[model samples]
Target: MSCSEDPTCQELLDHIYELVDADEDAIDERSRALLAAHAAVCPSCRDAVDAERHVRELLRRCCGESVHAPAALRVRVVSMTTRVRRTE
Candidate 1:
């Protein structure tokens, strides 16, 4: 089944954040299937997800270790993110 037959565009985008955040554990099997189906048809979303994965891989290779984000930086990021609303 394709995205249209299963997940709608909005549904795919909603789950895409988990993919972009590299939160594989957070994504359920259903979301993964929907994403795979969407990727088969939507080249733009597929390209974007691929790019995000590549960037994450590059960061991992460059750092070779996870760095703890400062509490203040985290707070600032959270505050900024909260100030903005997701647009469809």
Candidate 2:
């Protein structure tokens, strides 16, 4: 049932959002380990993780209720979401 044991489980796990909430070490040791193992062999999953990180950073930097990202970055994040959803 662990994500690392099954590609399908890994993919499903990657689609979840909480992976981004965890600290880097925790993410790597836990969440990202599954996705990282899969990503090592799968370019698409690598791209998804990269994109998710970028979007999360952008949100933290600019998209909070108290702050806003540049219009262009906002648009890019929104567009990335569309692409992410398609891949999922």
Candidate 3:
């Protein structure tokens, strides 16, 4: 189902990415149901789910530790946040 047709579908799509590393058999019924339903009706979501899984697997293989933001990127983000907060 298109996200516009069912808002829950988009939430389900998002949840699919979150659940990728979780134990499939241990996943809650609600998530499993959403995944099953979405995969059945939405090729785009299915592809998204597959792509996310592949990326996660690749990351796991290439980087055992979680990725960290570069110091420069972190400083830039902090500066941007500070400016935004000041403006607000």
Candidate 4:
């Protein structure tokens, strides 16, 4: 059954973002372990989790490799952000 119809699957999907995030603080180790245990027993949940990880890896490999923004653009953005206006 799909996650859309399964409560357990839906719960797993709900935490998918935390499951896929690289930041350790995104989810506790206990929670991650619990999800892993569930996914291990559920083929549908396992496939979903794998797909999310694959997509995240693809995005990181493609977009995360971009060079820093040009210095001119950075300067313009900083100038705009630092501009102050009088309230009076």
lDDT of 4 by residue, 1-88 (tens): 1222224766787677677663365567767777777888999999998999899778778879575679999789746644531221
Candidate 1 lDDT tens digits, 5-81: 47665666656667566455556666677676786788877886787779878888888756667999978986775
User: Which sequence of candidate numbers ranks them by lDDT, best first?
Assistant: 4, 1, 3, 2
Worst 10 residues of 4 by lDDT: 79-88
Compute the lDDT of residue 79 as modeled in candidate 2. 85
Off by over 4 Å in 3: 1-8, 23-27, 65-88
Name the lDDT value of residue 37 in candidate 2: 66
Model 3, residue 60: displacement in angstroms?
1.3
lDDT of 3 at 61: 83
Question: Higher TM-score: candidate 1 or 3?
Answer: 1
Ranking by TM-score: 4, 1, 3, 2
Best by TM-score: 4
Instruction: Give TM-scores for every candidate, taking all chains together and pairing residue i with residue i.
Output: 0.57, 0.47, 0.49, 0.59
Off by over 4 Å in 2: 9-16, 23-32, 64-88
lDDT score for candidate 3 against the true structure: 0.64
User: Each candidate's lDDT (Cα)?
Assistant: 0.67, 0.60, 0.64, 0.69
Q: Write the per-residue lDDT of candidate 2 for residues 1-88, one digit (tens) a residue.
A: 1345545534645544545555452234454566556766677666776787898787777757577568999689868976876796
RMSD to truth, every model: 4.7, 8.6, 8.4, 11.2
Which wins on lDDT, candidate 1 or candidate 4?
4
